[model samples]
Target: MPLALALSPFLVLGFGALLIMLAEAFGSRRGGMALGSTIVLFATGLTAAGLWMYGLENLKGLEAVAPWLLLDRFTLFFQMLLCLGSALAALTAGGYLPEHELDRGEFYALLLFATFGAMMVSASGDLLTLFLGLETMSLGAYAMTAFRKASPRATEGALKYFLLGSFAAAILLYGFALLYGATGHTDLAGISKVLRAGAVKDPMVVTSLVLILVGLVFKVSAVPFHAWTPDAYEGAPTPATTYMAVVVKAGAFAMMLRILLTAFGDAQSMSWSAGWPPVLAGIAVLTMTVANLVAGRQESVKRMLAYSSIAHAGYLLVGVVATMRAPQQAGASVLFYLLGYTVSTAGAFAALVLCGSRGRETVSYEDLAGIGRRHPAVALPLAFFALSLAGIPPTVGFFAKWFVFRAAVESGFYVLTIVAFLNSVLGAYYYIRVLVYMYMREPAVGAPVAVPMRSGYVVAAVILSAVMVIVLGVAPSDTLDVAVAAALSPG
Candidate 1:
């Protein structure tokens, strides 16, 4: 295949970013940028699907980029997920920006650029490409976090994220350098070969693995590395928050999967008796338990969701750890869970966006009082997504958790699975609280209540997300089959 045909998904996004940037510089009409970005993302998704249909293994010249940019089923799967998530976020922003008086063509440009970075991260196969993609993605996110110029919280959040994110990036780079020193290679496959050849016990390799895992843990907002998440999520514009919560998390996990399985996948390194599995299990427990406990106490719904995002990461980590014994099942479970998570999270945020208009935006639980009685269109979806997040029956979230837990059970992590189930029960309280405030409580006398905003963009996003959540929940086999095909072997 031609280079352009082989990299059509990435090329489309790259072209779209440049086009959006140029339009921002020269055009006065800012209204079309979001639509254009969404169109670009949809086109990118189509390209990825086309490649999958065309048989990625048969694409000529694909190996020419080997160990730097891999365009296999795994990469294509995340490309589709990233594009879809970013598109929904763009649609949400179309309404959110105008309503909040932050409308700017550059916002869309940044979104496109950030999405391009995430695509790169998903496709990366070497440490060089991986670091490049990570920084590119993080820089755009930092800017987006602080996009609201006049908001002090935005500035604070951006500053914290920039400082901490830069630090994490540096640590990851140092780890990569150490790995290179230990194995004399930057490509993950090469490193894995070296480790399997008898260097698994190298102190530098262990240190590099620990440092690399730390950087990735921060990206996923897991436990102690998660200090930046809630503040950043709450301070950023809602649309940007949605982007970070879904697209950014998905990209980080994709990179994590590639690195851990490709570079450090030796039996000794993946072992439950002495390796990443145990460490990740501990992080999973801490992340779920801590985040859930803190989330229940948050007054701001957005902040609560931020913690919710962290808690979900813990659940995904459970699946990640299960990969040691059940690579295919666990990997597919993680992918499907992320798919469910992306839709459910996007819908939840979109519903939150719809629950308020300009000057009456919802923030606190008090603001949501009586919303379900007045705005069934907004309230119903919000309730559905909330329940989904809590992993209730007959929703996509339920199946997502079920798959992950099932994988863990099959892998004999009975204690971890039980702990995760308990965390799920604990998590339900906060998610249900949102619904309780929406349907059961009444606003205080003379207090301003959030009114539903009217925007076709937001409505479309909510509908798209809701439909996916329900449809995938009802008939998951097709998606599961695709996920199974995408799973990579540790070797």
Candidate 2:
């Protein structure tokens, strides 16, 4: 395939991100027509079309367009997810803005840029490119989180996220520098070779590995590194929160897997499987246990959901650990979980959007009272999402968790598997509690009742997310089989 054709999806995303900036400059006055929605849809369409062409022409694996990027199947897989998630978020914001009187073009622009950044991260083949991509995505995300500049909590969330994210970024870059200094190469493939040659045992390499793990741990919200998650998720704009929860983590983990599989995949290094696996296993155990236990005690629905998201991150780390121990099937499980997570979380957030008339609710647990009686559509979808998060059967989350556990048990990581299973049972309590409030309790007197669904974007997002969750949950065999085939064999 032609290089331009290979690079089209990313280039389209980049141009689209910039286009939104241009539109912001010139189109600020014309905010009422859902122009933000239009731009996102058009960009998403462009991305889908480009990827379709690539697939039709048998374009798979890395297509090196520069020293920085490697357009490959792995990258395309995440790129498609990011674009779809971003489009869903845009539509969500579209539906949400009008009701809240905050409909503005810049909101869509930030969403596009954030997605574009995620695309860059997936496509990156070099550390410098990855760092650049991370910053682009992070910066855009911070802006979106605080888009409600008027809200003190929103501003506070943005500041906390930004400060902490900046620290993580710096640590990651330092780690990259150490890797480069030790290996004398910046490309991922080269780093793996250097490490395997005994260079990674050097003190510099050891320091670099720990620092790099710290940075990624922060990204994945692992225990001892997850303090900012609940606050940020609660304070950010809900649509932004959804985007961060789904797309950002997915993108970050994609890179995390790539780095582990490529740059660090050297049995001779002693750090590849031996070093990281136990560390991750420990982190996963604590992350799952702590997040779920804390989540169960939260009074605010949004805060509780935020903790649930953190626990899910721990579940994903289990999949990552599987990559080291059971390479082929485990990697596929990670991708599956990411897709499942994106769909379920997006659907759940859409329900939250419906409940609030202007922006999100104060979101007290009492706010959910009588929703099941008054608004079946919103209430049921929320219930489905909560069930999905809890890994209940007949939901995609069940299959996602099942695969990870299967991979772990196959690799003889019985203890980790058991802990994860127990966490799921613990998590179900809080997830089900929200449902109980919605269905069993009486509506708080004069609580805001959900209005009718409005906007094509809103309807599309909800329908698409709901359908995906059910279909994937019921018959994930096809997708899982394909992902298995595509996954690289563990080192």
Candidate 3:
């Protein structure tokens, strides 16, 4: 394939973003901007899927972008996932912004740009490109977090996110500098070769690993570095929250998996090379345990979902650790889980958006009481989404966790798997609690009124996500095959 053709996904998103910016700047009518953004994202995803069908290995011009952008099946997989997830967020925003009177063309533009950056992150093969892509994505997220500038909560959350994110970026940059100094290469393949050859005995490499790990885990919202997550998720607009929860996180996990596997896969002998896995495993334990415990205590539903995102991060981490022994299965499990989690999470947040209109936002459990009885249409999907999150039968979340836990067990992490399973059980309480309030409880007599809004965009997102959830859960062979192929393929 020609290089330009191979790069079509980037070109379409980049050009589409610029076009949207121009139209938003000059055009007074912003009615279809969300739809436009969604179309561009769908086009990007379709192009990526086309590349997957054509096969990345058959392409010749890929050398032109090598050691920077991989353009592999793995990258293609994540590109499609991010685009699909971001497109849903765009659809949600179509309904959300207008109903809340925050409808502006800028949100769609930022969403496109952010998704473009996430695509870059997934395809990045070098530290330079990785940092650039990560910051590009973060800047978009920070701006979106503060999109509701009139609200103090939004500004506060944005400030916290920005300041902490910048610090993490700085640490990551320093780690990259040290890594380059130690290995004389910024390309992940080169670093891995040098490390495996044991050419570098520099203590700086160990320090750099810690720094980089800190920065990476923060993006995934893992514990000890997850302080920004709840506030950021709670304060951002619902669509923005969905983007952060799904797309940003998928990029982070992609970044983590790539960097760890490519650059530090063989930093030392197989005896806990670089001492990363044990450290990561410990963090996973803390993340799942702490987040599950705290999530159940939250009064605000959004904040609880924020914590839920953190818990899922921990679950993904377990899969990462499983790669030490069961590389293919573990890696495939992570990819498949991300696919399931993407749709499940997007649907849940959209249902949250759907449960209340501008004046009747669903803030607490109390706000959701009797909603299932009041709006069965809205309540039914939310119930399914919540069941999925809780890992109930026949839902995607059940299979997602099952795969992860099975991979962990096959890898000989019996104790870790048990801990994760127990944490999952504990986590189910909060998810089930949401359904309970919606179905069995009743709102207080004098409580603030909340009503479900009607919007074609959000309804489409919910229905589409719900269907995807069922398809993935019931018949996952095809998706798992694709993930396994991506996992086993040479990067």
Candidate 4:
């Protein structure tokens, strides 16, 4: 295949973003921007899948971008997932921005551009490209977080996210710069070769590894670095929150996998007793424990979901740590979890968007009281998604967690697995609380109640996410196969 065709996913999204930017610059109507961006994303996803089928190795001229951007199965898999998640976020934005009187064309432009950055991060094969991608994705997220410029919460959240994110980026850059100074290589393969050959124990290498790991763990919203998540999720528009939860997290984890496996996959560097495995295990424990405890205390469902996002990061960390002992199984489990999470989280957020009209947003539990009886349409989808997020049986989220836990057990992390299992049980409480309020409780007398809004765009996003969640839950074999292939693919 021609390199352009092989690279069509990146090309389409890149130029599509520019076109959307230009259109927004000149056009008056904002209605078409969302559809345009969604179309671009769907096209990118379809093309990436097609290239995966065509085979990455068979494609010619890929060397033109060698050692910086790769078209491996891993990259292709995330390309597809990011586009799918981004498309859903854009669809949600279509209805949400208009209904809230925040209709601005730049939102779609940011969506497309942010997705472009995520795809870059997924495809990055070098330290420089990774930093570039991280910044691109983050800038768009910060802008989106402050989309509601009138709200003080939005401004504060955006400021915090940007400042903290910038620091994280600087730390990551310094880490990789040190890596280059030690190994004399910025390409991942060269770094790995050097580390494995010698200098694996060099003080610089050790320090860089820790710095990079901290930068990555922060990006994933793990504990000790998750102070930005709740405020950002609470302050951002719901669809933007969905984008961060799904697309941005996926990209960050992909960055982790690529950097860790390719550059630090040496036995000594990944060992359970002396390396990142134990560190991540400790982080997984803290993240799940802290996030679950704090989430249960949240009166705002949005804030609860924010903490839930952090908790899920811990679960994914378990799978990452499991990669120390079982690379293929653990890696595949992580990929599958990300896929399931992308749909389930998006669906849940879409339901939140549906639960609110202009003035009566679904912020607190009381806003949701009697919602199941009054707005079955919105409540039912939330129920299904909430069940999925809580990892109930016969749902995508359950399988997502099951595979990760199974991988952990297989890796001989019985105690760690047990702790994770207990954490999940604890996390379920907040998820179940949603249903209880929606079905069992009643709004206070004379209290303002949420009136479900009607928006085909929002409903479309909800249905699309719900269908994927159910289909992948019942027939996960094909998706699992793809994930395993990606896991076993070239690092």
Point to the candidate with the largest lDDT. 1
- Model 2: ten consecutive residues of lowest lDDT: 56-65
Predicted structure 2: lDDT: 0.79
**Candidate 1 residue spans exceeding 4 A from truth:** none
> For each predicted model, how many residue pairs clash, with residues at least 3 apart or on different chains?
0, 1, 0, 0
Candidate 3 regions off by >4 Å?
267-270, 488-491
Residue pairs in collision within model 1 = none
State the TM-score for model 1.
Answer: 0.99
Of 1 and 2, the candidate ahead on lDDT is: 1
Tens-digit lDDT string for candidate 1 (181-248): 99999988999999999898999999999999999999999999999999999999999999999999
C-alpha lDDT score of every prediction, in listed order: 0.93, 0.79, 0.90, 0.92
TM-score of 4: 0.99
Better of 1 and 2 by TM-score: 1
- Residue lDDT tens for model 3, 286-310: 9999999999999999999999999
TM-scores of all candidate predictions against the true structure: 0.99, 0.93, 0.98, 0.99
Worst 10 residues of 1 by lDDT: 56-65
